[model samples]
Target: MPFAASLASAAQQAQAAAGAAGVRIETVEDPERLFAVSRLLAEVWATPPGHDPLASDVLRSLAHAGGAVHVAFGPGGMTGATAAVFGPPRGHDLYSLIAGAKQGGRGVGYALKLAQRSWALERGVATISWTFDPLVRRNAWFNLVKLGAHAAEYTPDFYGPLDDGFNTGDRTDRLTAVWHLNRLGTPAADIADRPDPDAAPGPDGLPFTARDGRSLWCRVPEDIVAVRGADPARAVAWRTAVQDVLAPALADGYAATSMTRDGWYRLTRP
Candidate 1:
């Protein structure tokens, strides 16, 4: 199929998925709806007293300027939201700035993303890009496995210091993801043939670094949030270790291809 037709087909599939999940997704143009989105972001990310990342005015401006500020509603009111900024004209991509959901809101995040994709496709954008913390295992699964997005770049401390609930003490390293609206199957299908990494501990009860061919395996703590609370130094150690492994590998043209259920990042040379 041609690129535009394929993208349209993908968008239809996404809309179907959202409908099956029974969530109402909407673009926030009204001031009241935009404020609700801002409040949702504040509550979901647990922004500190004065550090709301997406204030009502910011969301309104983005929406008014042809960008997407989508909100998802469930039985319990607003459940999830996503915001994206348009890239430069030459880039032909939408940069998804942030997405978050209320805790325990199953399927809310996925539905919101489907809505974002559908909205972008209707506007003729074929690619959607976003940055995410590589250490978050569940996010890795959602972005790479479930949504069929690929990591294109890795940056160290991309946001300096994030004082939000999930990113309080950690350096803000992130993986930039590129989701091709016209080619969803390719990314998810590529995972099956890759070699698996061993997460077993070595002699010192520390996780072993494993590799295969041109691929390097890296690990994050199973529960980084709990680990950070119990042992800040250890959490930092994981951060530094991941940065050491991923930064150089990505710089050398290796991409994070797949993540294991046990939190291993498989960085492989193309």
Candidate 2:
């Protein structure tokens, strides 16, 4: 099936899947109109108040690639959206995971995933990566615990300053996760074989260092970023930063044999 047809078919299926959710899914073609969408998305993402939506370079990039952007419309009005870039199976490539205040729990996001799956399956794209606020356990459960993605690394201040409902006191700490779209059938079984995430870090943690004073992994991702970005006087301090980019390494054959309860995860390759 051609890519466009695949998207349309997936979208139709998604519309059916949304059954009575009063949600409609469709591809967004007007890049310029995204200014309005960006404002909504920024609000949904909880970017600080008064955020500059015009600085949305990422959205521009997606449009440039001719990526498929889907928005979910509920009876009330706009609910949410998801976007993906279709490409052949390859590393060093990524997709975005942006959801809005859609009424249904994960409905729009699920629709977007199905659409991406269709595109990926047709193009032989094996993996897809996206970033989400780590502190948001809901996203974690949905993306990693449920969808089988993992935290590869911690990106400090993924986006700088501005306004969002959730970023008031902390800079957004994000985790990058992948969806092995080419995998046949449900990925639940495959997830069973993967190791678990590390336990939460503690005060008695080991000293972690990055290139210029960032933690080796992440400590209260949102908090640390807030500290780091908040005051130049108070340098960011944490037990972990500069994580080993676990998911990619693991997907590339590395394995997590064990994770300490004290928040340390050990990985090995077979």
Candidate 3:
């Protein structure tokens, strides 16, 4: 589709998503609204007092410089927020820095993302990229399957040791997700039939190797956050196991194409 037509379609989709989420999306420029976003994000991440992922002053600066800082407002006020900045000069890409939605708001995160996509498409940006912990299964499914993004790279300890509630004790192994603006709703095909039944098991009896050369399955903990809280040691072991399998595969020309609902990642080589 042409740029104008594509942007129009994206705008419609974003509007529909926001309506379905029971929220109103807005590109925030006011300092007070930006501060609200800061607080919302801090609460979502369970950050320590006075420690927010992105401070309001920083958000103001980004907004002033033409970056996007979108907030979602439901009946209870601000429920979600997302921030993205332009990538390298002439890169034609936007790097989404952070996004968080309050718990129990159905489709709120999805609405925020679609709003961000429309914002990017309107500016002629061709892609939006962000990083997420590869061990998080629901996030993998959301980014790769629901949003039609693809994993481009895997980096271990990408952010070092984060002090936030979610990343306190685990390695920050991340997968870079790239969303091509033109390919909305078209994710890479799932090639793996099923996790190899007879494959050798890794930590927690999860499959880690590619018995077949073209593709293979790697499993992650069903609920990594709960696992982290209940058994930190086991969580760390899961991290190391996934890193051992996925990092090498991504480096060796394999891309994680899709994630199963049950926490299996299908890493495939073209």
Candidate 4:
């Protein structure tokens, strides 16, 4: 099937599910609704991190100005969601990556992100940032290689003691990734248009521009299955290898933003 048609079919399913539940996954136009979304995040990805879905504050912050959030619901509750708040101080929104079991797989996350992309593009925003646990190879492919987002290495313990949702006291290392939300297609294709470290900045004024950013970055774990062993030698090897790629990019100006709690990878160069 053609890409456009396939996308449309998936969207139809999402919308149909929404209608069945009398729920919509768009921005919170009302303040109370915004609070409701934060509450949902706690419920969906945090509490059962396991507990009640109404126990999160991370969802609340995304409601402020220059912010945006999306929520999905089923017969009893929300299925899954993706939220981001655009800005500088918080690396332009690299918050949570919580998906409910009812969501199934990438289809839901992809749809939510596409919605976020559409919202940002309409506003002249060029990028969307987020973090993910890097240990999971699936996210590495989805966020960096597949989505055309780049990654950056961040210091360990990036978010000191994160025990909620998917994170549970291991290594807090992460990689920050960016979806050139505005140029999702062109940049991911045509290598000539893509950022080449040697080239000058674009008219849009981005990294390698006056702001000083790296062109692109990412990491694929050398050994996927046994990466998190407690062996000190293996630990050093993993840390060193990941840091080498991310550190240079950071020193060159890429900063870590979103992180994957399940995999321990952080998206950077934001």
The model with the greatest TM-score is 3
lDDT tens string, model 3, 115-187? 9999998888999999999988889888888898888599989989888889999888899998888876644
Compared to the true structure, candidate 1 yields what TM-score?
A: 0.90
Please identify model 3 stretches exceeding 4 Å from their true place.
Answer: 186-192, 206-210
Better candidate number, 1 or 3, judged by TM-score: 3
Q: Give the worst 10-residue stretch by lDDT in candidate 3.
A: 186-195
Task: Give lDDT tens digits, candidate 4, residues 1-270.
Answer: 654554455456556545655556666546576555555566545554334433244456545545666765545655566666666663433433443434353355555665565555555556776666555566665665445676544556666655554444356667666676533321222233233332442222222211114334333453433444434355445555555556665767665333232222332334
Ranked candidates, highest TM-score first = 3, 1, 2, 4
Task: For each candidate in the order shown, give its overall lDDT on alpha carbons.
Answer: 0.79, 0.51, 0.86, 0.50
Off by over 4 Å in 4: 1-24, 29-36, 43-61, 74-77, 89-106, 185-241, 244-270
Model 3: lDDT of residue 253: 85
Residue range 1-270, candidate 1, lDDT tens digits: 976776677677767766766678888788988888888898999998667878889988988888988888787788889999899897779999999989888787888888788788777887899998887888887887778777869888999988888889889889998888765533432334445545765322576467777777776667777777888887787787777778888888888767766666777776
Give the Å error, residue 236, model 1. Answer: 0.3
For model 4, state the Cα shift of residue 146 in Å: 3.4
User: Candidates' TM-scores?
Assistant: 0.90, 0.59, 0.95, 0.56
Per lDDT, the best of the predicted structures is 3
Task: Show the lowest summed lDDT stretch of 10 residues, model 2.
Answer: 209-218
Clashes of each: 0, 15, 0, 29
What is the alpha-carbon lDDT for the whole of candidate 2? 0.51
